[model samples]
Target chain A: MDKKRIEIKNEADIVLARQAGRKMAQSLGFGPADQTRLATAISELTRNVIQYAQQGIFEICDQSNRKAIIIRVMVEDFGPGIADLDKAMEYGFSTSQSLGVGLPAAKKLVHKFSIKSKPGHTKVTMVMTRKRV
Target chain B: MKIPILQLKNLLLTSIQVELTDRDAIDFQYDVVHKVAETGAEGLVIDITAMDVVDSFIARALNETARMARLVGAEVVICGMQPTVALTLVEMGRELIDVESALNLDHGFEKAQRLISAKKRMPG
Candidate 1:
């Protein structure tokens, strides 16, 4: 398993995280479409970190075995957590002036997604898996 | 990174060929709108053939740019969105619904010209 962690603090970090994630995905044999999806997913999540949390940690890990290759990502922040998780997931429900599609879009791009948030902490985890052919 | 906005007659042309940060995206939006107003251009073509990812932020930036250009009486056509990027954008549910798009730069220029002429023929 290979793991890499990046600090998400500002807009530049958002770009950095997504590029690194895309590079990792490419190195792991992900196709062009999947690579773009992974990069876009990372972009959305890291942007949320900058906009909402002010800072966070973005981790991408590769856990590939004989049968399948699994890529897992974790985003953790220490900002004021989402008060209404369900509402936040809804389309067009944005606290800011944004389109509010970040969280939901990130979720949709990945294979598995889950979120846990409190007042001072929020963690989002996502996984994408492809069978080894 | 600075995206150069080139003017050709009554049309403004620009291509986003870099991995843009949020700041870059916002700057590009501002630059395009300002260029449109300065040149009194009737049409604009933004090529994103090099952009492999069009997340919600970039998508919103492009949409806002197009809207701003239209407000200044310019027809905007975005072109050269990669197939993978389009797929990802659709799956993410953040479509660029507010903007006009074409398959490539040539087609986009043609479409933008057509729209500009059509608008000109309309009585204001």
Candidate 2:
């Protein structure tokens, strides 16, 4: 259960964090498509961090057992958290006026997804599992 | 010479082959619209097939560039988005409304041609 943490403070760090996620996925035997998924998800969360809070922390942890290789991710920020978590998770309810599809889309790409937020804190966690063939 | 947009025969083509830093994305938006002005191209095809990720920043840049291209009288068509990138964009709430997309580069050309022709026929 080793975890690698990244601090996202600006736009450039989002790129760096994605690169790190890609390398980790490769080393963990994630296929190109899944690597893209994980990396893209990281981008979504980290970009949210930079835009909303201006800074946040992300962690990627390996949680494999005898069955499958599991990649767990946690993204937390101290920015103003989502006021309406339900609306945020809805596919088209976007306050920022982008497509408003990010959170729901990320949920669809992973094995597990969860989120918690308040006035000054927001945390999102996702788990991606790959079969060890 | 690190040109962000390439022009050939009345169409502006840009392939995002690598992960673009935010600065690059912003500069790309600037150059693409101005390039439309310089070349007077009737169409634009942005191939993001080689790009593995299209985060919100990149998405905004692409969407803005599309709007700007339209403002300059050039039709824009996006092509070569991998399945994963498309899905990611969906989840990021970046539907990129108003941007036309095609399955691949070949189809993108066809779509752009149709759009260009349609624009020509419209009363200006």
Candidate 3:
């Protein structure tokens, strides 16, 4: 696993983090669709950081093989975290005026996605692979 | 809700004044793009200044609107993006380049007029 990490503090950092992750995933030969998915997933997570946490850390690891590249991203933030994980995961549940599709959309964009959050901190992990489904 | 079609000289401006929420993002994209194409406008300016926040979906829709507009010889300019809204959009890595932006409706109209004039100057 080739691991790279970055900390996101502002909205600008989120853009950089997502671009970095997408570039790394592409360099490792992830398919275009997967690359776009990874980019979108990272975008969603980083948007959360800016909107909710105001700061977060993003980590990307690459797992390469003959079949495809497996990319994993982890975003962590310390802020007023989620009180109800289930409710937050719902499609139309938004604390802000947003469509509340960030988490759900991110989950759909990746092969696997998970979230762990408390009152003061939240962590989201998403994984994407080039292996054909 | 119906999308209002505003004709301005050679350009056609369509206003979809729906809530810029995630649930409406896809519909907004479809309606706006369809109307822009149907009107055969030389350029399109999406006025989202009425919206408070633009999420990933809306941002994506803007990008798509630009792409779709371009396909029909029309350019799309997104105007009235709030600072915070712009920040969120930038963080989301959505491409706004395809759609030119203005600070407000007046500014967008000015830019659009200039662009239309520029196109007119160019030989077909």
Candidate 4:
């Protein structure tokens, strides 16, 4: 259960972070489907960081045991926080001319998701767990 | 990296062989449209068989590129999407809906040609 942190600065950082997430998920015995889910989720989150916050950090860790495996991810940025959390979470609503599915869709990929934001800081946390077979 | 766009008669072909950053995706959209216009191509087929991740940004870029190519008088076909990518997209709320797709490169070319000819027969 080692923790890893990635810096999110630009579009390239988004790709790097997602690749790292997928690699870690694969090593932890996750399936292709779940790996993809984690990777895609990370991609969206990091993208939001770049688009809105200009920069951020992507942190990942595993908390698991004999019968189940849990993956935890946190993306945080010190920038102008979201002006409206409710609208940002709504599907098909985007101020940046994007698909606006980044936040809500990312939430669906993981088992647990939460977010908090203020004037200078925003954090999104996600947990994905699967029982080992 | 800038992807190479090849030409075959009235058709233009390109394949995304690596994962692209957001800038690369936008550059690609620009490149595809300019290529179509430069060649006055009738059909364009983009093969993304090697791409493993088509997140919302890439998906939007692809759909936008398709729209721009169509506006510039070329029919577009996107082919060879990985099943996992397709599954992930579906889970992400149905992206890539604006473009035509096929099973593989051969089918993609055929589909693009069909679309091109179909448009050619239009009254306008």
Q: Highest lDDT among the candidates is held by which one?
A: 1
What DockQ does candidate 2 have relative to the true complex? Answer: 0.51
Q: After superposition, how far is residue B31 of candidate 1 from its true place, in Å?
A: 1.1
Q: Per-residue lDDT for A10 in model 2? A: 83
Best by TM-score: 1
Give candidate 3 misplaced runs (Cα > 4 Å). A64-68, B1-9, B12-124
Candidate numbers, best lDDT first, in rank order: 1, 4, 2, 3
Q: Model 1: which residue pairs collide?
A: none
| Ten contiguous residues minimizing lDDT sum, candidate 2 chain A | A97-106
Native contacts kept, each candidate: 0.96, 0.59, 0.04, 0.72
- Pairs with steric clashes in candidate 3: A99-B22
By descending TM-score, how would the candidates be arranged?
Answer: 1, 4, 2, 3
At residue A30, candidate 1 shows an lDDT of 92
Models sorted by DockQ, best on top? 1, 4, 2, 3
What's the true lDDT of residue A97 in model 4?
Answer: 79
The digit string of per-residue lDDT tens for model 4 on B1-124 reads 8999999999999999988999999999999999999999999999999987888888999999999999998999999988888888888786545689998999998899889888889997
Score every model by TM-score: 0.97, 0.85, 0.57, 0.96
DockQ of each: 0.92, 0.51, 0.08, 0.80
Query: In terms of lDDT, which candidate is stronger, 1 or 3?
Result: 1
- Tens-digit per-residue lDDT, A64-126, candidate 4: 889889889999999899889999899988998788999998998888999999999999999
lDDT values of the candidates? 0.91, 0.83, 0.72, 0.91
Query: Using alpha carbons, what is the TM-score of model 1?
Result: 0.97
Tens digits of per-residue lDDT, candidate 2, A45-86, equal 888887778999998889998899998999999998999999
**Candidate 2, pairs of clashing residues:** A99-B93, A100-B93, A101-B91, A101-B93, A102-B91, A102-B92, A102-B93, A105-B91
State the fnat of candidate 1 relative to the true structure. 0.96
